[model samples]
Target: MRPDLTEPLKLLAVRVERVLEQVLPTPELEPSRLHAAMRYSVLGGGKRLRPLLCYAGAAAVGGRTEQADRAAAALEVIHAYSLIHDDLPAMDDDDLRRGKPTCHIAFDEATAILAGDALQALAFELIANDPGHSTERSRLAAIRTLALACGSQGMAGGQAFDLGAVGRQLTEFELKRMHAHKTGALIRAAVLMGAELTGQADSHQLAQLARFGSLVGLAFQIRDDILDIEGDTEIIGKRQGADIARNKPTFPSIMGLDAAKAAAEDTRQQALSALSSFGPEAELLRDLAHYAVDRPS
Candidate 1:
C-alpha cells in the first residue's frame, strides 16, 4: 500500500504562477528590448512542471513554499530557453509549441536565439543575485545546481545525443539515458534546490528526495513516450507524431506499448517508495508521483 499523498502535487502549480510573476521583470523597465524577448519566451507559457517539482521537493522537507520560489522560477527560465532553441530551424524546425507558434516563428530566429541566450544567463543571475535567499553561499550553490542541470552534463548533453540519434536504432536504455540528461537533470536539481531553500535539509532526507526526483524524472519521459503514440495534439499541445516523424527512439518503439505503460507504472511505484521515509510529510510528493505519469501530456 502507498500513502495517499495528494496535496503536495496540488499546491505546486499554483505556487509556480506566483513565482513567475515575482521573478519575471516588468515591461516598463529599461533594457526593454531584451526584457520583451525574455518575457516573450519565459512568460509565453508551458506546463511549468520543473517549477512544481522544486516546490514539491521543498514541501516534502517542510520548507516554506515561498522559499523555493526563486529556484522554481530559475528552472522555468532554463526550460523556456531550451524550448526556444529546440524549435529553431537548425534543430527540430518545429513551428508549434504548447498550442502556439514557436518563438522563432512568432518572433525572428535571431531574436529567438538571443532571447534563449539571455534567459539562460538570467536564470543563473536570478539565483546568484537573489537577496531573499539570504546567503551568498546558498545562492552560489543554487547557481551551481542550475549550471550543471542546464550545461554539458545535463540538458545540453541530452540535446546533443538526440541530434546524433536521428534515424538510428537505439536500445531502450539508450533512450532512457538521453532523457535522463535532457529532462531528468534539471528535475533532480529542482528538488534539491527546494531542500536548499529551507536553510538545510537532513542528508538522509535529501537522499530520499533525490531518489524521488530520479524516479519521477524517468517516469516523466516514459509517459511522454507513451503519450507521443497515443495522445492527441490538442491535449499534448505539440504535434503527436513529431518523435516518430523525426525517427527518434521512443519507449513504444523499443519496448512495445504495453511494456512502456508497465515501465511507467513501475517508475511511479518506485517514486512513491522513495518518499516512504517522509511518511505523510511528503504528501505532495506522493500526489505528484501519480500525477506525473497520469497526465495526458
Candidate 2:
C-alpha cells in the first residue's frame, strides 16, 4: 500500500509558505502596491507541487528537507510569477487562480505585470544568494538550472507553443513536446535543483532523477488536462472546460479521456521505473509521482 502523504505534504507546504513569507517583500514596503500584488500572487493559494518535488528530490539523494528550502522557495516563486503572467489579459485572460481573483483581476494590469517581473527577479536572487549553498559552484548550478527552465528553451518556449497551437490540431508528439517545456521544465528544475543543492547526487543518479522528473511532469500535465474536463471549477480552482472553450490542445482532446487517464498512469509507472535504482530513500519521490496523477486538483 502507498504511504499516506497527507501529513507530510501539509508540513512541507507550510515550510514553503514560511520561507516565502521571509523572502518576499512585505506589503508595507515602499512600492507597496507592487509588493502587495507580488505577495498576493504568491502567498495564499495553489498546490506547491514544484517545491515538494524539490524536497523529495533532496530526500531521494539522502539530503535533508531543510537543506532544500531555498531551492524549493525559488521554484515556487518562479511558478507564482508564471501564473501571474499567464493570467494576464494578453495571455489566457484568466479571472480565477487558486479559487481567487487572478493577479490582473485583483489588481490593475500594469501592477500585475510588474508583480510577475519582480517575482521573477526575486527567484534568481534567492537562488544566487542562498547562504545554505556550501560552494559558489553549487549555487551557480542551481541558478543556471532555474534560468534555463524559465527561459526561451523551457517554460516560456512551451507557452509560446501552447499559444500558437490554440485552435489548431496538433499531433500527440507535438502536444507532448509543448507541455514538456511549459509544465515539465520547471518541474524538472525543481527535482534537479534539489539534488544539485545537496552536492551529493552524482551524474548517473542525477540522470535517473531527471528521467523521473520528466515522466512525472508529463503525468502531471495529463492529469491536469483530465481535470480540466472532469473537475468542478470550485474543486479544480479554475474554470472547468476552459481548455475546450479556448480550443487549447490537450491530451484528452487528442487521445480521448480514457486514453489520457491511461497515459497518465503509464507515465507514472515510467517515473517509478526511473527510480528503480533507488532504495527507500526515494519513497517520497515515488509517492509524489503518484500524487501527480491522483491529486483532485
Candidate 3:
C-alpha cells in the first residue's frame, strides 16, 4: 500500500495557507476591492497542489517546511493569478471556479484583471523579500526560476499555444509540448524553487529534482485532462467538460482516454525513477507523483 500522507499534506497545506494570508493584502486596506478580489481568487479553496509540491521538494532536500512556506505561498499566488486571468471573458469565459463564481464573474472584469496583475507582482515580491532564503544569490536564483516559468518561453508561451490550438488537430507530441509550458512550467518551478531555497541540494541532486519535476508536471496535466472529462463539477471545483466546451485539445481528446490514463501513469513512474538516488526523505515526493496522476480531482 502507498504511504499515508493525508496528515502531512494537510499540515503543510495549512502552513502555506497561513503564509498566503499573511502576504496577501487585507480587504480593509485601501484599494479594498482589488485586495478583496485577489483574496477571493486565492483564499478558501482548491487542492493546494502546487504548494504541496513546493513543501515536498524542500523536504526531499532535507529542508524544513518553514523554509519553504513563502515559496509555497508564492507558487499558490501565481497559480491563483493565472486562474483569474484564464477565466476572463477574453479567455476561457468560465463562470465557475472552485465551485463558485470566478474572479471576473464575482468582481468586475477590470478589478479581476488588476487582481491578477497585483498577485503576479506579489509572487515575485514574496520571493525577492523572503527572509528564509539563506543568501541573496539563492533568493535571486529562486526569483529567476519563477520568472522564467511565467514568461514567454514557459507558461505564457504555452497559453499562446493553447489559445491557438482551438478547433485544430494536434499530435500527442504537440499537445504535450503545449502543456509542458502552460501547465507544467509553474509546477516545475514550484519544485525547483523549493529545492533552491534550501541551499542544500548539490548540482546533481538539483538536476535529478528537475527531471522529477518535468515528469510530474506532465503527469499532472494529463490527470487534469482526465479529470475534466470524468470529474464532477462540484468535486473538481470547475465546470465539467470545460475543455471540451472550449474545443481545447486535451490528452484524452488527442490520445484517447485509456491512452491518456496510461500516459499519466507512465510519467508518474518516470518521475519516481528520477528520485532513485534520493533516500526515504523523498518519499513524500514519490507519493506526490502518485497523487499527481491518481487524484480524483
Candidate 4:
C-alpha cells in the first residue's frame, strides 16, 4: 500500500513556494508589467510536480531540501516558461491553464512572449549562480542537463513531433518517443537534477534514478491522455477531448482507453520497482509516482 503523502506534499509545496517567491522578481521592479506577468505565471498556481520530483529525488539520496531548492526553482521557472509558450496561438493555443486565463490571454501576447523568454534566461542564471553547488563542475553539469532537456533534441524536439503528428496516426513507438522528449525530458531532468545536487549519488544510484524518471515520465503523459478523454473540462482546466479535437496521437487514441490505462499501470509498477534500492527515505518519491497517475488535473 502507498504511504499517505498529503501532509508531506503540502509541506514541500509551501517550502518550494517560498523559494520561488524569493527568487522571482517582484511587480514593483522596472519593466513592472513584464515582471508582474512573470510573477503571475510562476506563483500561486499549478501542482509544481517537477519541483516536487526534484525534492523527492534529493530525499531519496538523504540530501537536504535546501540543496535542491535552487535546482527546483530553476526547473519550475523553465516549466512555467514552457507553459506560457505552449499556450501561444502558434502552439497548443490554449486559453486557460490551472483554471485561470493563460498568460497570453491574461496579458498581451508580446508581453507574454517576452515574459517566457526572461524566465528561461533566469532559469539558467539561477543554475549558474547557485551557491549551493559544491563545485563548478556540478553547476555546469546541472546547466547542461537542463539545456539538453529543454533544447531541440528534447522538449522542443518533442513539440515539433507533436505538431507534425496531428491528424496522422503514429505507431506506439513513435508516440512514446514524442512524449518522452516533449513531456518526459524535463521531468527526467528534474529527478536527475535533484539527485545530482546531493553530490552523494553514485553511478549505480544515478542509473536507478534515471530509470525511475523515465518510467514516471511515460506514465505521467499516459495519464494526461486518459484525462483528456474522461476528465471534465472544468476540472482539467482545459477543453475536454482537446487532443482528440486536434487529432493528436495520444495513448488512448492509438491503443484504446483500456489499453492505455493498462499501460499507465504497467509503467507505474516499473517506476515503483526502480526505487527498490532506495530506503524508506524514498517514500515521498514513491508517493509522487502514484500521484502522477492518480491526479485529477
Candidate 5:
C-alpha cells in the first residue's frame, strides 16, 4: 500500500526537478567537459525527496515555499555529490545508482571524483549566493546549515563511522547515532535551511521540525533496513540485502523486524505530533512521515 498522498508528492517531486535543473550551475567556459560531467551527475534522476522535505518544512512554518526551493536544490546538489563519491571504486564500488550506471561507471573514476568535488563546492556557492536572502546573516545561516549537515559533524562523519564499523557489532544507540548523523543530518538540514531561507527562525517550530527530522530520519534508515530484507534491486535501485551481505549492524539485525516496525511507527507518530499546530496543511508532512517507513524503496 502507498503511504503518501501520491498526487501531491508527485507534484512536489516535479517542482524539485525543475528547481534542480534551473538552479544548478550552467557554465560556458574553456573546459566544459568537467562542468558537463558535474551537471550530469547532479541532474541525473533520483527521488529529490530531500529538497521537497526542505520546502515542506518551510511551508509548515508559514514561510514562502519558493524561498525554500533554492535551499532544497542546493542541498540536493550536496547529496548528489555524496552519491557520486560513494559509488567510486575507492568507496562502495557501486556500479549502479538509482538503477542506472553509476558516475564511475558512466565516466572514468577520476572524472567521477572531480565531478563530486565540483558539485560539493557548487552546493555551498548556490546557498551562499541566494539573492532572496542576500545578507551576511542569511548567507552565514545557509552556509552554516549545509556545512554542519554535510561536514564531519554530519553525513561525512556518519560515513566515517560506518566505514569503521563494518563486520562489527554496534549497540542500538550507536547505530542510531551513526544514522542520525549520516542520513538524518541532511534530512534535518533540508528543513532547517528551508526555514533559514525565509529568515523564519521560530524556536519552537525549529525544535519541533528538528525532532521530526530526527525521528523520520532514523526511521528512514530503519525502513531501508526493512526494504533491504524484502525489496527488489530493480525497484529499490540499489542492491537489496547489500547491508546484510556486508554484515552491517541494521535495526533488524539488532531489534528484530517486528520490533523495528513498531519503533518506526512510534517515530512516525512523534513526527506527526511535532506538527500538531499546523492543522490540516501539515497533512503532507504527516503523510510523508508515514511514507518514510512504509516506502518500498
Candidate 6:
C-alpha cells in the first residue's frame, strides 16, 4: 500500500507535540517561572520543520519512526532556544514570533535568557539520554553532531557573520556561507542525526543527505527573504520588510527578487536530485523541500 505523507505528518506532529510536552520540565515545577518561559517559547508555535526533516532523514534510510523521535524533539528544542535569544534586546529585538509576543516580551528579559539557556542544555540532555540508539557509540555520534552544529562553527558563528553583514553589501557566496552556518547547520544536523539514529546508513548515504540538507536550507532561507518582501505580517506571522528596515543582507538583496525566486527553485531541484537513490521512503523529504520554498510563511 502507498503511504500517504499527509496523514503521517499529522501524526508525526501530534507525536512530536506530545513528546515535547513530556520532555520539557513542567511549568508548575520548581523554578516555575523559568520552566513556564521555556514552555511558552517552545510549545504551540511554528512549524516543526527541523523535527520533520529529522523524521524524513530517518525514513530515507529505512529507520524506525520511534528511533527518530528524541533527535527530532531535541532539534526543535534547540531551534526554540535560538529563537528566544534571537528576540532578545541585544539581538534582533523583534516583539513578534509565530504571530504572538516574542519570549522576552511575554516574559521578563531575564527569564527569556534563562529559558534559552535551559532549552539549549535540555537539547543535549535529550539526545544523550535517548534510549532508542542501539549502542553508546551511536548516541555519542548524535551528540557530537548536535553539539558541533550549535557551537561557534555552526549556528552561533553564522549569527555573528550575519550581524556583521547587516547594513553592508555581501557577495552571493558570502551570503550563502553565512546562512550555511547560521540557518543551515542545525538543519543539516537534524538530517545527519536522523541518519545516525538508524545506525545503518553508510557514509555515502549520509553524505548525500547532507548535500540535500544544505541545498534545502538555502532554499528555505531564500524563501524567507522572499516572504519578507511579498508576505503580509498577518499571513507570515512576522513583520514584513523587517529585513529591509534592518538592512540585513539577504538573497533578494544580493540577487534581486526575480533572481532570488529562481535561485530557490534551482536549489530545490538540486536538493531533490541528491535523493535520487532513495525510493518512496524519501517522499516526505522531497515534499518538505518543495514546501520550504513555496510556503507563504
* lDDT per residue as tens, model 1, 1-297: 332224545456666767777777766887676667678777746777888888877777888877777788899999999999999999999999889888888878888898899888878877777666446766666677778888988999999988988899997778888898989988888888888777678889878888888889999888888889999998888999899988889988999999999999999999998887786767767777887888867
Which digits, one per residue and each the tens of the lDDT, describe model 4 over residues 1-297? 342346787798888899999999998889999999999999998788889999998889888888888889998999999999989998999998988899999998999999999999999998788885446776777788899999999988998998888889899999999999998999999998888877887888888988899899999999999999999998888889998998888999899999999999999999999999999998888999998888877
TM-score of 6: 0.96
lDDT string for model 2 (1-297, tens) is 342356777799899999999999997889999999999999978789999999999999998787789889999999999999999988999999999999988999999999999999999898788775446877788899999999999999999998999899999999999999999999999999998888888999999998999999999999999999999999999999999999999999999999999999899999999999999999888889988888888
Tell me how many clashing residue pairs each candidate has.
1, 0, 0, 0, 0, 0
Badly placed stretches (over 4 Å) of model 4 are 1-5
> Where in model 6 is the C-alpha error above 4 Å?
1-5
Which parts of model 1 have CA positions greater than 4 angstroms off?
Answer: 1-11, 30-33
Candidate 3: segments with Cα more than 4 A from true spot: 1-5
Query: What is each predicted model's overall lDDT from 0 to 1?
Result: 0.82, 0.91, 0.89, 0.89, 0.80, 0.89
TM-score of 5: 0.93
User: Candidate 3 lDDT (Cα, whole model)?
Assistant: 0.89
Q: How far off is residue 106 in model 4, in Å? A: 0.9
- Model 2, position 295: C-alpha lDDT score: 84
Model 6 residue 14 distance off true place after TM-score fit, in angstroms = 1.9
lDDT of 3 by residue, 1-297 (tens): 342346788788888888888999998998999999999999999888889998999999999887788889999999999999988999888889989999988999999999999999999998888774556777788899999999999988988988888899998888989999998899888888888988887899889988898899999899899999999988888888989987889999989999999898889889999999999998878888888887877
Candidates 3 and 5 compared by TM-score, better number: 3
TM-score of each: 0.93, 0.97, 0.97, 0.96, 0.93, 0.96
- Tens-place lDDT per residue, model 5, 203-261, is 78778778888787887888889988989999889888888997889998999999988
> Cα RMSDs of all predictions?
2.5, 1.3, 1.4, 1.6, 1.9, 2.5
